[model samples]
Target: MARVVVDVMLKSEILDPQGKAVERAADRLGYSTIASVRQGKRFELQVDGPVDDAALASIHELAESLLANTVIEDFTVRVEDN
Candidate 1:
């Protein structure tokens, strides 16, 4: 089996309300050493065959089209050896 990992994060220019809230909560909980937090999402896809360049390219397309919003978010996709 092979694994593909997709990480999605909001664009730096976009406002992240959820991240800000978590940061504030962390500060109130005595985690003030942390400067900020940017929340994001991860998607792990399991493929039945060997991971190759073609699979990586397909995963990249999937991540861009379905997993992340290109307008407001950026995504990185990587394949993990199984």
Candidate 2:
């Protein structure tokens, strides 16, 4: 079996309140070196066979259509090493 990973994140122009809250918490915890934080979502899919170019293409389409909001978010799809 093969594993596919889909990572969805908001566009840079979009405000991330959850990320900001995390950053603020980090600062209060004395993590001064922490710069910024951006929260995102990750989806893992298990495929019955090898992940090839065609599979990647299909996953990309799935990410675009179902996993992400194209207007304000971006997503990347990749195969995960076993």
Candidate 3:
């Protein structure tokens, strides 16, 4: 089987309250070297056959249409090495 990964993240301009909260918590926990944080979503898909260009294209389309909100988020699709 082949695997594909889709990573979805909010746009830089959008506010990420959850990420900010985590960052603050980390600072309180004494992780001073830590910088900012942004949260995102990851989706892993398993395919029954070899990964090809057509499959990649389809996955990209799916990412754009269902995996992410294009107005506020961006997504990347890639094949995962087994």
User: Quick one: RMSD of model 3?
Assistant: 0.7
List TM-score per model, in order: 0.95, 0.94, 0.95
* Candidate 2: tens digits of C-alpha lDDT, residues 1-82: 8999999999999999999999999999999999999999999999877688888888888999999999999998888888
All candidates: CA RMSD (Å):
0.9, 0.8, 0.7
- As for candidate 1, its clashing pairs are none
Over the stretch 1-82, how does candidate 3's per-residue lDDT look in tens digits? 9999999999999999999999999999999998998999999999877788888888898999899999999998888888
Off by over 4 Å in 1: none
Ranking by TM-score: 3, 1, 2
Q: What TM-score should be assigned to candidate 1?
A: 0.95
- Compared with the true structure, what per-residue lDDT tens digits does model 1 show for residues 11-63? 99999999999999999999979999999999999997777888888889898
Worst 10-residue lDDT window for candidate 2 reads 47-56
| C-alpha lDDT of all candidate models, in order | 0.92, 0.93, 0.92
Candidate 2's TM-score: 0.94
